[model samples]
Target chain A: MLCYRAWVETRWRFLICLTVMLLPSVLYFHELGIFPMQHWTSDPHYAYGLLFGTHLPSIGIWTFAAVFLGLGGLLRERAVGTSTLTLTLPVSRAHVVGTRVGVGASETVALALAPWIVNSSISLFERTPFSRAQAGWCVLLLVGGGLVYFACAVLVSSVVEGEYTAAALMFALVYGIGYLADHVSGFSALNLYPLMSGTRYLDRNTNLFPGPMPWLGILASSSASALMLLAAVTITRRRDF
Target chain B: MIAAPAIQTSSLSKYYGRTSAVQNLDLVVEANRITGFLGRNGAGKSTTIKMLLGLIRPTGGDGTILGRQITNPELNRQARAHIAYVAEDKPLYRYLTVAQTVRFAAAFYRDWRCDVAGKLLREYELPLNRRVKALSKGMRTKLALLLALARKPELLILDEPTEGLDPVMIEHLMQTIVARAAEGTAVFFSSHQIAEVERVADQVCILDRGCLVLDRSLDSLRESFRRVDMVFPVDVVEREFQLPGVERIRANRRQMSVLTSANAEGVIERARAFNAVSLEVAPVGLRDVFLAMVNGLESAIGKEN
Candidate 1:
């Protein structure tokens, strides 16, 4: 846990990006004149409501934070030669890698739920209905996206040798997948940007408007994440360091 | 008669793609002795140490470290716990303070001696609060040794632990190694500092170009190899000064320094026949032995070429 905290303190870019991710939702509520008091509800002008309404885009924030933070955690130690010290410990390599991944995932989950909790609390005073299941599902999808992104970051860190090169490669991957998903119809399944867009079954009646539910995309992403994690563990176990 | 050797390798070989880094390495590090692994740059010292620690997979043969199989990961981990390794580069976490690094190392070993760590920090006068990156090269090496020593391991594998330090620090490091060996911890370290090794190590292994050229006890080494200093008469011819069993001979004016592999008797006989005025045969130390071996290898290679 101290390792995680130390990493977060050193990695200011990750903190800045996380702040930027939350800014849109916070500003959306403020723009609608319901930030401190009422929560953003379904408005007559916009069918999809504001970004922080029942259809808040928490998954996007979660995925971005997870990928950025996860890569930083895994790569910074190696870049600074701390991984050599970490590996020399009596603990198994798997345990060290798992602890780092677990801490990164935890941070992603916490960041994902921040806006939801704030909105839910304010909705109580604003006389707007808050569905606990809808928020929970949103958090779950964000976690799933985070898990996938975290696994991808771990794999990238293992394969790339240098710090700057690995980070550049990760950025390229995130943006490349997102750009392709937006333009190509078939590639959206691979895009991690719109994590909860496929889960329409859970948000039918609520003010939240879910997009086309692609079950195959969720299944594929989950499987890829599992495989990436397995590969990372294998590489770590067999590595010479 | 003797306790089982703490570390033994037989016909161990490791290859990096097409090049062989360590070939047919045979070594036996006995219990309760300080062994110095002496070698020139790229002499396979680091490669052999890595194989002994099971860090790199050996291409041929195997060895036992602390009575455990080398290839087995679980046993390797267990064996590693009993032995402490300080790498050649003295690599450490730059972001962590000295105290944090010590604590981090303590978290792994079951028998971590925090008291020893504390004592060493005080004894060495290390700044525990300073970040490792802020430390000087010598300080980093001390902290690395401190981390390894705090584990109370039975065997300590140090690779060039004192490569770049002042004479005072080198002497202090040698004293610390001697103190540790006195406590019954077997210390095996590599160094190019022959005088330092001669001061503390009982056993010496000399490596040259990925081969173990010389391995012997320091006492036996001194007895067998001798440096004979002789002053030939001014009338004696230089060509007539050549003697059998002489490994190396260097002369200036009337004095000739002959490094002989034979005992003092043979060197004396040759010196007398050459009409030498004065002859002194001094016992050879690691420095003499190392120079002889390296020069011998270079000459042999020169001849081959």
Candidate 2:
């Protein structure tokens, strides 16, 4: 029932994100009939060099969705006058926090996988040659390099009060880090965007990640995500509701 | 075996930097009885409840619920299995239907009584499919009460349980509270309604400014508390009215009114010696006691300062 409660609390956000993320993929390209025309076959690389030719800028959209998915928990419930009900439950705070995060992270993975797969099926229906391996790598890279954003949002929401306040701070923090990664040499290591979207490995001629994957980057990013989630749980457990 | 007190706190205090929310409160609420926790707004009643439930940590002292340590998270979590609480706001998930909220709450406790929940559902006439956010305030309070009462816990903690209820429903709820206590469930509720508390609570604890000023059984209070009205000659020193049981003495030139918790007869004897023109002793009700304890305490502090 904890899982059920978490799902009920966040089901709308998940569905809305799924609908919005798939909107451009389902309607935007198909309406223009770009897939039926010769704009793709003549060039070696796809239009705008979209990752794997079917991602729909999958990393950026999924990161935003992840942050939205992580917007609520005990602290956010505190702001909304529901934390008392939650705290009065017989379960440990850790169990409640874990269940919420587990549901959200599962939704995050679904966000990453479902959209790209649907896009790949659309590519097949349109007679385009989108590689399944390329789609798989896009998912691996997106999840491995992108879950930290979800974890970051969770930590911020766990400690901060007010939903809009926490969301604004999360966006500022994410975009600020993105800006730093672009300009500052010291922050180049923080540039998760390129890794998640696989822009660096994108073949200018093929728009595909053709070589070996970044195992070190994935390990490091996944570790950071784990650490951030642990921090969120600790904050939830130690702090007053 | 004798059961431990449903709640026990020793010097339990919560301080926020320089501000004290709850200060040095030592309270014990035993099982199988109704204990009304009375206080005005911001008197630290809610804060004390939160600390006892492990929703917030106590900064200065230690406490226990059902004999388990409140400071120990694991022990407190274990203790909550037998404790049911309804918050002052009746905080239910807005996204969930009334049925879903009840179902979700039932899943957490081993003591959940489905028969009672079903009975309450019909009694309260709560729409099972209606979202809680769409329910009326009175309906929301009913739903919250249903959730707590259905738990059949060893201890039931309710904060402002009767707020936003109709008279009929409040009456039914009062009967239900008494029935629950008769069935061996201890009830500790906080409310501003002194009349309701007087009707239902076996014992009353009045809190003011985070301090517990009065804790006594209702029978004892009725027997011992009194208001003495007297008119003495002019120029009688107020200090002469001092006695062990005199709680407060109000003087207006010659006429004096004395409130006493005990020794009302002794106060009357002194009044006779002072050549009182008129004197009358009346039983003090719970409302007067609460007001004098809370507002009168403020006046006492003012006079001392």
Local accuracy of candidate 2 as per-residue lDDT tens digits, B1-305: 97789999999999988888899999999999999999999999999999998999999999999999998999999999999898999998999999899888888888999998999999999999999999999999999999889877899999999999999999999999999999999999999888999999999998889999899999999999998888877657779888998888877678787889999999999999989998999897898888888887234323322
Q: What is the C-alpha RMSD of each candidate to the true structure, in Å?
A: 5.1, 3.4
**Candidate 1: residue A182 Cα off by (Å):** 4.2
Model 2 misplaced stretches (Cα beyond 4 Å): A23-51, A123-130, A202-210, B297-305
Interface RMSD for every prediction, one decimal? 3.2, 0.7
Worst 10 residues of 2 chain B by lDDT: B296-305
Looking at candidate 1, what is the lDDT of residue B218?
89
The TM-scores, one per candidate, come to 0.82, 0.93
Question: Global lDDT of each model?
Answer: 0.71, 0.87
Clashes of 1: 0
Interface DockQ per candidate: 0.33, 0.85
> How well does model 2 score by local distance difference test?
0.87
